[model samples]
Target: MLGDRFVYVAISTILAFSYYILPQKNEHYPTCPTVEIYRPLNYSENKDILDKIINDETFRNSSLYKMQQAIRINTTSFNDDLPLDVGNNLDKFQHFTKFHNFLKDEFKLVYENLQLNMVNHFGLVYIWEGSNTSMKPLLLMAHQDTSPINLKTLNQWIHEPLSGDYDGKYLYGRGSGDCKNLLIGHLEAIEELIKIGFKPRRTVILSYGFDEEISGFRNENPKFIENIYGPNSMYAIVDEGGVSLMNVGETKLAVVGTAEKGYLDLSISIEKQGGHSSIVDKRTAIGIMGQLIVEIDNNEMPTYFIDKNPTFYQYVCLAENSIDIDTKLKNDIFNSQIDQNANENVRNFINKDKYTAYAIKTSQAIDIINGGEKINALPEYVELMINSRVAVEENITIAYNKFVKDTTNIAERYNLGLNVQMAYSDEIIEVIPATEMGKLTIKPITMLEPSPITPIGDKHWEIFAGSIKHLYEELAYPDSKVVVTPGLGTGNTDTKHYWNLSDHIYRYRPGVLPSVNANSHGVNEYIEFDSHLQIIAFTFEYIQSVDALDD
Candidate 1:
């Protein structure tokens, strides 16, 4: 009997250890076809093409200097005086005029040839007319604005967010790496390309949207570009998104966004009898709101990856390199049958990595909740703002429905009045009578569906990949190898609105590394001066090569 008891305790201990203590990462396994380092047989340029930009020491220094100046100016989006549907984020269009004039002064060659149009008196569009009308134009995009920094966090920065300080190695500011690197880097290349008499046979358009950080109430910039370029006329649109390249231990991957997830905001409000805090009951508005949060937290919709190629996450898992996989891990991913246990392991593995999990399923976060105006008062109302990013397999309607069903159940359990909007429309979908009337209300403040996937089977992919090859060969990891693969952006970018204009949209933030803690779109955002130079070099080659492609 004692022996039986000991065995039972031992088994319990083993199960607990496996469930709680084991590492979430499992990169050692692979059926990954995209794991190999890609090498092209032919060269896009005579290898000397990279020299034109690399050799121009004076030009390179000037470009980086100009970038620093650009960052110093605050283009932070504000609730400005503009029409709501236009989605103007700038405090005023006048704020962008100085930066526009600055660019014109710095890159003389660019403004001279390209017809620089100041859109809506705030946004910018630079046109470089191509010789061939037969070929669609190539578009490069990035944003001019960034997220507003809190005044309270000013001292927390190593360098002030607006100071635009270059600390010997990094150019520091709010928008440095997020989009400015590409934004300025491309312009730098164009200025130099024109100086060297490198003319693009294919029309090249550079779009700088004023508001990309907040994801406008309307996709203003993309729509404007679409109208000018004509619907679906773009050969390709390159924008900032996802990890352009990632480094995992010894293995490196050149990442590109072939598709991106969409997002929406869900607002829930609850009201009850108002009184002093001392008279609080078992179910005040705040108390009921707290429980609802708990239920939502405990009942997150499980991620399903049963179908082999249902989502991009599965495709990435299958395409992962064999060399990265060990025998045991390989068996676990492949030999294991498509059972509940196997699927559970895969789901856990994905959720462990911050990036891959988002690619697999829709995610939720309760970002904002407000109740009493005063602490002492028995709060009469509470509102919760939920931000959800939907996966490619799901739609906005389905995700919104699930939210309604879940929240409704919560309201019923608490016997509270529940009001919620099922979607983006003005009509309120549900009104559950609570202890008080108008006690609860939930509505969607925003909604954007996931983008369509742009497959990689054309010369466009090759030319883009070829650009990576040329840049990496001369620049990237000397020892660590890189495999270029198709990836879906877990978050959206300026490219979101440009989707209809092109069948092929590639989001690659050039001069960025595949590393954690990149500090993008966060405090202490910075970019390596060297990477910026290489990006400029890469852009020069990418456009010149595309110009050579057959019609």
Candidate 2:
């Protein structure tokens, strides 16, 4: 009789796990509506205008040379590996004064004409006052900082990371691609326009902030942003979020970021007691943590392949004709677009493209871990750090509640007493027993929800679509016309702070040159000099296009 009862319970447990892990029936997905986007038929006259601007032999050569000079500066925030720099380390940002001086010299035309002010010297803002002050201003933004270079991989780079070596085709350096390129592109465009004796009809604001790479991102120039372009005063704001160009297979696509994913850091801890490793227990602290990790991993937060809500998938679905995905997969997307029970085949299909898969779901990665001290001693405490990108369909509150419930179930399965409960705020620390809950505790280290999704129907979307279309057309690549799509950025940008002032927030960097060896934080970061020029072209067109907007 006892054996039969144990077997019955075992079968029930297996079935329960199977039901949670593979909820194959809950295929019902929210549907993100597709915007009516049309591909360009003929290259616009704006391309001709941009070509004329770049055709200036004298201006083009000098501007490219000066851009290389700008990249050569050691304007980095830290020395590779050694974060804390002592006296006279030029790259440790003591050279910032020199960098600023170089900018002032290189863009002499900009300073001589445009009114400029330093936001405490750390943040740089340049204002070109338009003739029509009544028109809402356009703000262009890019970060001034870059990630710290890794010393262990320093020798692996083709050129010195700070050398800004231009190898006739590519400009190689730390900040070359991650951001500095965009900043220089904007600056170069303005400088050249000034040389051409061009004056704007509407105000143009350029903002460069520090601390984008740091953990605690503190903006150095709020007052400047306030006094110039205050709340509800700006028409549109652009920042680096997504690539202006991306190629899935044979087809080239121009992607503009309309939304950014939210972030959350969870530290899962399971504590018991420490003893000699030889003294075996039914389950150790590490064992409990393992079970919890497995539970979360196996029963990952449900991902949406299709549903009623608007998602980036809608854009991908529209581009289905362009992408090289299988026809069956495309059919699966449509079949499950509205059903509560979406086809599992569709989920499997979309998840195949790691890039597109993430935009549709909340992602979690276990990044950090801490536990035992010595091999001989058993671990009483185990902690794991999970970094999650919250999806638009879910909030931190809802997602975290699920996490707690999952933890509870997992704990109950192990027959472990979980005296501790989870709370989401700040970093987690190991402590002696305090409250009487049980053995497990989960807490959030950091939490930030996804950014608001900008509407594709707005005038800002039209301007973005137009500017990107023109920019891509001028590239003359992909052996055919490019398709434009609204995308959700997997990462966050400084534009998050500007959400209050502008609703039409866009995150995109103009032109992405496809490369097998791409590294945003690793060795040999670089960008094609021509790709840099495209940003300037896009900036010119975007401003021109928006200037036509009725106030």
Candidate 3:
């Protein structure tokens, strides 16, 4: 395995040398149906205010200033060894306290008007009580923490990681992209609504978690959803993970993340007997672990399209709208479900692009390993952890079973006792050797099944899609046709914990296609100024649109 700094440098080098190749354009191609919903009431009035807010020099400058201040705070979350209850570890969260003060100072109106509640010390929840109590509230989520910066790569940065430097076009900072920009954007929108005297009839909730980068918030006791809001109480949720606006000739695709991949971290623990360097067994624990790693790496998850998957529908949109794709490939993708040959062809095509390949299949990465104490000793115990982002079409059991099948023969050959939980059954599999020389145990550190797909073509979807279309058409890309299509997030988000809150969950961030190069979770991270402004506009309009829905 590579060191953390080496991995970052390697990725940065690859991206630096990469050429920006434009896709070939074709004028005529098939396209998915565009959503058609009536514009929010008082459309003209709302548009006038939005136009001013986006164009005003003072507002624009102040928005950028707010984002810059946020980026400077440096609220980086880490996966520390200490437990959450430990006060020494809690001291590391001091920056979150500073960030809270900044939010309160910057968005004074919001803090004064909305009801504020803090969860687990760092999680912030604000509610703007609406007139009607019967209607479910709209939930908005963003994380306050950012990924840690590599200390070794400090000098390679174009601007200091926490400087909050704005170089005319891009706002340079660590959290500019993933994602203090989002946290500030939500606050900016809410503050603007208050300025314009716009109060919602349907309640609106804002949630900000301090440790989403390290997946810490997901494990916190007394979940915010259960305490702040009850099950099935929200109309919809909009979070921080979604694809950028993909360009398709004269039109753009607003890819909304309807479902997310599942998560699994399987640790293979091998235990045997230790010995001095000269007296080694047939195979040491480290040697056995290495062989298992190779076996797992060689057998990757297969790529196949499932019609029910949100990714399959995303391709349906592309097959209909994108002219850059080859005609034969488009046809094969369109006919993949019914025709076996075409399905294979489509699968082959998916493998060409790493992004599409991971979307269809479970991703495997050998991230961590530990063994041996002394330099010359044969290790007695070893542990290898394989991380996987399971595809939406599969579950934890299926992924676990695949790993078991891949290494069962190797484990049996070594005369090792196997201990595993039976797939799809409550029974356990415990094979004890008469005189065990070694033992292998496979257990999940964290396991989560794929999220439920949010239903489309319904009223809930209509309002969500309508707001997206309105935002792009009227504010961001007025000249191009904006098409709203279902999408799948390759990575998980905080919304994983809020699954029961709403069936209309959407994880979307309004970013342009070119903005994907913003260097998120990497060196020189930044967000385009125009893209950040668009986010504020979308949030403002989405609240009104959802509030307009009938009881």
Candidate 4:
């Protein structure tokens, strides 16, 4: 009987330990530092002006109607056929030209040649020059291209995919969320501003690239930036990348991305003498290559923290408080204990599925492998392809060299001939925070570092928090924290393009992104109608607050 009691107690303890170690849902996460809140002046308070701006039927109907129309037009613009090429299709060029002409007619925008090179394609840029001649311009950018869908599955859309059905609430179609909305939002915002006779203190330029989906390879973007900003004239630029609404314990937080990780594509090959089916060798080239892949998957890059980028730290800190004791320990190792030794220890404790594990480590996945040509015979050569995300501080070259050396060492142990080479490597951009005085001297102006770390606090953060809270008080999770994240983005988008041009680059999309398998870059992509309205309100409030600055 005593023995049975002992076993029961032991089982209970083990269960408890497992529970403590498991990752908790983010809804139970703790809150980080709160941002300052401000009540925006009621639009009614500035009724005459606000009314003229908001209630302009021509402005509202025309802009929103045009947005809906553009959504329909652009959705059909996607090439459903395989091997989608925007460069080759003359029809695609015509679509862009029509869109360009429409903007020129509606906004009085001058169509000018970027004149990069004769080979470089011609792209359109719209400039809304501000009354204040001294201040550098702000660029509002979005792409016009849509990634082609599979022809067979294209008809599976909730709407015709290209139908652009308003349904009185949500805009259902492709490019609606990915970027078409952004394009419409900018145009509508400008139209509203124009209706109120409100001119920006700084010039606001709207630039659309036709081939952002396939990388702006034609050099249209660089040429456009140079032509407008005169080499180095941009005050700041905003692009699309990181915009997330995360549940932090009882609070819902908004994360704005400031930096992105770099990408590296690598290939490993092992060569050995061909052998007969009957003569099997354990240390064959295929075996060596498989071992190399396993080693990479097992070994993670060193974890480190960027004190300058506070968002990631804030996330870790919140995660620590929200999770159970064992999970908290895991969070601590990732956020604060990123030292070499601590990371090694954490690596042993946690599995690969957790966000903490991915955040602090360089993830390696075997994307492709080629070995034996047939079931009966071993091929002379085996090739392996791997994709790795290097940590921020780790140089791509250093990481690549380390990978090669490590593979070589493993191959030598097996007495196999191995060759490793980098297929392609991209540099990671770091965010650096800066401060600027607002037009209102009393109001502090803050900007993220050219290379900011995650979760850093800034003036724009306060504006975002305040604007969101003011507009969505009912849905407002009080303990919500505003954090600037640099590491959250999975190195997606052409951030590298803008990173080269300006220091004050922020990536955010104002919407309540659904948690359960939100369709982004996938089928049935859609955004809620209320979310769209809220985002627009937030944008208006943000612009107003920033423009009110006096200094």
Candidate 5:
């Protein structure tokens, strides 16, 4: 009887373990949408239409070609004759008027009702409305202006930076990457679509801001939107925020910027009684300022402040696997042994990409510090300029208050007679959830939050994964593990402007990430030739997928 019972128990245990170990089959797990499969449009049959609009040697080399040429002309914000400063209002107007006239003659330019009146700078608004009125409208945005590059540096280019030299692959110029390419891309895409008699189901609108390089704080962009769209009618808006590229591990990831951290400019001032340099005092303004800087450098903003929002955390989890085990363990280390080991192991990871590591952690940078003017003189006042990329979850006021309190405590501890005061601050913007068609949901969230974990069974995930797999065979790296999830962007962009109006914002640029260097705002910013070709094809495929969407 005992032997029989033992055999039955063993059999039962094995059966239960098998059920646990084996994969459970479920029908609800969504598959990629059929539309994602790239089927070449009957271009050969529609050769006449394609040739007339996109391929016509003259039209191609004429309209978009001329516009591309115009983009090559140097238009810096700091030109002595055409400064964008408030005092140079007339010069600014003249520069914009020239572009306005050009756009009017070339494209159908409709003037917006509202005008932006900056202190000395002026802004222009031109719109190109689509023919379809029944469907919702989409806004494609790009800034027209470029930041001023040093005059000395301008002459240092291999070819003139503003010359717009098209070496077949790249159009080398000042605004080439900072965003003339995007502006020109929109125009070329639209012109091509129109020539093919392809009327979009939804209306497409273009918004080009002239004062973006100087920051749009003083501009009346929100008012202009109110006048045109009437409040909440836009379906989606695309601006320069994040781009798709290969990550450090050569993984092709698309960074669709949903939100951006607010920009904060802080000035710390310390005042003290002046004394002779030879007669050194225990407490001086310069000494106090030095102490405060050290305190900020040594300490980090608490990790609890990190918002583990879904969109951000999802990317983090995916990236976590690619990182070195020791680096990963250190970042996540909570115990004493792990913490000690982390300091050594994390150095390699930290050295690889300081900016990315800093994005995962809070950064406090001291840009400017001024105190004593003359040697052998005791400074009566000391000032420090701090720039912080505050996390969205934390309020600027709270962060500022914390800084002040911490500075005060440190001063007291060192017996430094210093008073720390905050000069300026702005609130970090928060991401809100947006609901779309029953199958799709986009949240206008920033990278400050950890990647959000959405159910892998969702149709959107499946479609994205399948599309990537179909287009790029090498997408599944190492062991067929497909990382088809949203990622957090460390850089800031104009994503917040649209996110404020609606939540269905997604930051997606279909291109491989850079492997050699960081491009944006950096020197030698260039996109790969094959990458652009791939993006154009991907755009066609994406549009087809959208058209095939069913209720």
Candidate 6:
């Protein structure tokens, strides 16, 4: 009996030691309470609007027809190496005016009621005067441009790329998925609000850039953004982003993008002595270029678990909510704050999913490489372009410095002169020796630092997130539970331009997950009619929710 007691105490001691040493799985993390409200006067009226959106066939068809009309007009922006005023390019830009006309014709009420201001002839800014001018206007943004479709894959589309075909299930088109849906949806919401006699207490400003695909509006027409909506002029800016509702185990997540990755394009040029193929040198420009590419690939940047990064917080939310996540992973994610090993483990797990990995890590791609004019001759010159999406944890200067550091050894070994074109400055940074065999030049074709992260856990965030949750609960899903968490956008958006306009900018487009994932820039690009409706309904409810806020 004494021996049995001793064994029981020994086993209990081991269990206690293990419990203290091992990372424990936490089922609760920081989460915001759902702030859902409907003004008593508009409560029943809003419900009827939602019901008509869902059940009324004529209402639904009208919305669908508007989307089709917007998509049918080809507002495809081209990234040609020429000015807008150049030969034939001006004709290409005329398409935007056609789109503008279509908007005026289709949404007659919106055109009639709201005051429109055309920025630089193409950019659209509409002001819907609210009852109270004291309240800062809510800025709703959507680009009026679509990525130009590749002619090679034009045949791969089910319907013509510009058909705007509705097979009674999917509405097939280019701009339909990526933005026109949001643009038209915003109008649909406003048009419906007008019909229902709902006057907002806060002003509504709709801003649409014509050349978001090419990143033109911000650079060309800064006068409008600076003069009209100067620094911190708006209440909040909501652009098209934050991927639709995603599911983790039984918990559905409405991920809202609080931050976006910076963009940098490094144009690397190598110059070497040219020679006949018969008298080829051991090392040519192409050969050295190949080696540099390999070295850059091998020396990938370490993915850090930054506290400021929204993706890190997203995993924390997932660790607490996702029951189907691996036990070890969940524990590591929770302990990552204090433990370095746990942090690395969480990063590795995040890296396993490539879809979400880019949001946390700086992404590099050898997009364009040019060398060798002929097979019989050694190339005299070669050029390579490396596109990098800078991570939120780092800035443009750090990213640029890292590239220079990584390739310094290779440049030294080949006795090549190094030249770096500074991003923000006009002066060229170079280290060229008189006896150098070759020259290596690195220049940034375009450089944009990561956007300022929108503050979370604030009144604006709660209202934005709460509106999402309320929309999902009341109209979107009705049955499924949704957890609204801040997410990081892997790609840059037009919101990058409007950062100074408001600190409370949110990048989100409400829709179902699977349908939202349907080929954004690829072939078979389409948008489900049902998902489109959700966007319209969310916009309508979201506007009203923000209007009710006191400050």
Off by over 4 Å in 1: 1-49, 52-60, 79-82, 85-91, 306-326, 331-341, 436-438, 478-480, 514-516
Residue-level lDDT tens digits of model 3 in 1-551: 46988999998887654422222223342335357644778777877768866677787898988999999997998777656553556677877899899888989999899998877777888889999988989999888888999999999899999998987878889989888878888988898889889889899998888778887543342266566567888988889877767764444678888999999888788888887979887788888888898888898898868766777777777777776767677767666766688789978877787766887899988899999999898898899988899988888888888888655755887777777765445565775542357888777777889999998777877887878787777676676567788888888888888887888899898866323468888889888787788889888888888898865
| lDDT, candidate 2, at 388 | 84
For 180-257, candidate 1 gives per-residue lDDT tens digits of: 777888998887678668777899999888777767533365667777767998888888765655665445567777
lDDT of 5 at 536: 33
Number of the top TM-score candidate: 6
Instruction: Report every candidate's CA lDDT.
Output: 0.70, 0.68, 0.79, 0.54, 0.48, 0.80
Residue 317 in candidate 4, Cα distance off native in Å: 7.2
Cα error, residue 66 of model 5, in Å, equals 5.4
Stretches of candidate 4 above 4 Å error?
Answer: 1-34, 38-68, 74-95, 98-122, 152-160, 165-170, 230-232, 271-288, 302-309, 316-357, 369-382, 420-487, 514-517
- Each model's TM-score, in the order given? 0.86, 0.80, 0.88, 0.69, 0.68, 0.93
Worst 10 residues of 3 by lDDT: 18-27
lDDT by residue for model 6 over 1-551, one digit each (tens)? 99999999999999877644554754553443334532333566578888788668898898888888888899998887766433345666888888889998999999988998877667788889999988888999888999899999987888888888998878989987888988899999999889978888999998888888887543333346558657787889998888677877677888889999999989888888887988866778899999999988898877978668887777777766776767777777877776789889988877888787787789889899999998989998899899999998999888877778766767887888888777777777777651447788888878999989888877887778877887777776677677788888888888887788888878898877433487877787887788888888878877887898877
Between which residue pairs do clashes occur in model 3?
Answer: 30-320, 31-320
Judged by whole-model lDDT over C-alpha atoms, candidate 5 comes out at 0.48
Model 3 C-alpha lDDT versus the unseen true structure: 0.79
Q: lDDT score, residue 58, model 4? A: 54
Clashes of each: 11, 23, 2, 27, 19, 0
CA RMSD, predictions in order? 6.7, 10.4, 11.0, 12.5, 11.0, 2.9
The C-alpha local distance difference test score for the whole of candidate 1 amounts to 0.70
Ranked by TM-score, the better of candidates 5 and 6 is 6
Question: Which numbered prediction scores highest in lDDT against the true structure?
Answer: 6
Ranking of all candidate structures by their TM-score, best first:
6, 3, 1, 2, 4, 5
Residue by residue across 162-210, what tens digits does model 2's lDDT show? 8878876788888788688788888887875675566777888888876
In the range 253-358, model 5's lDDT, one tens digit per residue, is 4444544544555666655566678886665667767877788877766432122422333334333434433334323321212244533343334434664444
lDDT of 5 at 63: 40
Q: Model 5 clash tally?
A: 19
